[model samples]
Target: MARNDGYEDLGAWSEFGTVSGMVAARTTESLTEAHTGLGDRPDDLDGLPDVTVGVSAAEAIGDLAAELSPPPPKGYDNEVDADGDGTLDDATYRGRADGGVDILVDVDGDGRTDFIGADTDLDNRVDHADYDKDGDGVFEKRMFDDDGDGFLDRSVFLNPGS
Candidate 1:
């Protein structure tokens, strides 16, 4: 008799007619550990460890369900402070369902806003304090990260990319 290999079930298009992808991650811990000692071991999915310590397949099932759950709207992780003044805007917050665009705009029509868009860094909500050493329009964007953090996240360049 041949040993039963794990199975994968996939689904497309939710019942409500919305686009969705579903994947069932199944593993047999007892089977995986038992097979490792055998000379004629069946194929195993290495990406997912067969023996998840004491973690049962039931737990993995719940995790799969959570992963299959619909994704949240964009910038869901970003804590926006449109009302930096401790107030909420009457206009509906229009954050994207993807985490790409996380920008805050003045919603209350108040002239006093946090960090001018051109300022980039919200230091004092103004651009004058930034290193505009060259008096050029593209200030500080050319700065390099000597520490190599993939950004000018810290420190400033005097005349980078000039």
Candidate 2:
């Protein structure tokens, strides 16, 4: 038994001796196979085992079917892992049901600054300027020249309610 066992089974050391009747009991399979090879032992008397298999982890749990137990399902909390990085931002692991969090970060301390909503364009742009974005008073917005004519074109507006 020791020769054929692999640690993957984890039964040899768990239940070393005495039949545990576990579904993973390798000894049972071996004994069943050996019965066929008993070969000319006798045709009159009932055949019995010369040795008994050992117990298994399944038997330790008082469940002979433990050996055949399937693995538990691994699930996910989308709200917990919105970023899917397997980590949380802070020690407060409060799993929220919302997709994202809302926070305020004032980089310039102007008393009113929303990083995500700040004007990316510097053309005195508040929200929809294709040129001079970044709000630094510079025309880095690259005036939308879709036709390469160096000018702005049709505006893309947003209906907040929509």
Candidate 3:
């Protein structure tokens, strides 16, 4: 039901509304299927709205839910071979609501985090990092952005065993 004249307009509007509607429709279908075991009866009709209105309201609520959802996290490319072993290690991504992303890498493949890279300003730049340089499962170095700028302005070193 929405119209767009150009790519920019389309990009600005995105597909959240349509996606939400689809999600709601699927959800409704699943719920209906799950509840079908309850035999049809005239008395049950009084408590529920008409199907069309219920679907419309569900879609509107889905749209609101989609708007409130957070962006998906991003992963690092294969270019970052930190250990120089010519193989990529595993990593996880978390998105910040205000801005940017946080990446946690398991450099040794031991199922523990070894490094964290963050872009707190959403500028596609690394503004902070915490590293477990000794690979002992404890972070020993912290980099920070002091002025809210997309740049690391200070570094603090923690005890090796801490």
Give the TM-score comparing model 2 with the true structure, all chains together: 0.14
Which candidate gets the maximum TM-score versus the true structure?
A: 3
Count of clashes in candidate 3: 0
| Cα lDDT, model 2, residue 143 | 23
Tens-digit lDDT track of model 1 for 35-135: 44548767885766677696555446635654554443443332333334566333222222332222334343532222212222322121221232222
Each prediction's whole-model lDDT (CA): 0.35, 0.31, 0.62
Q: Which ten residues in a row have the lowest lDDT in candidate 2?
A: 88-97
Measured with C-alpha atoms, the lDDT of residue 63 in candidate 3 is 47
RMSD of 3: 24.1
* Candidate 3 lDDT over residue span 107-155, tens digit each: 8766556777776655655677787777765678997767775556798
Error of 1 at 140 (Å): 59
- Say which prediction, candidate 1 or candidate 3, comes out ahead on lDDT: 3
- Give the TM-score (vs. native) of candidate 3: 0.39
Worst 10 contiguous positions by lDDT, candidate 1? 115-124
**CA RMSD of all predictions:** 23.1, 27.0, 24.1
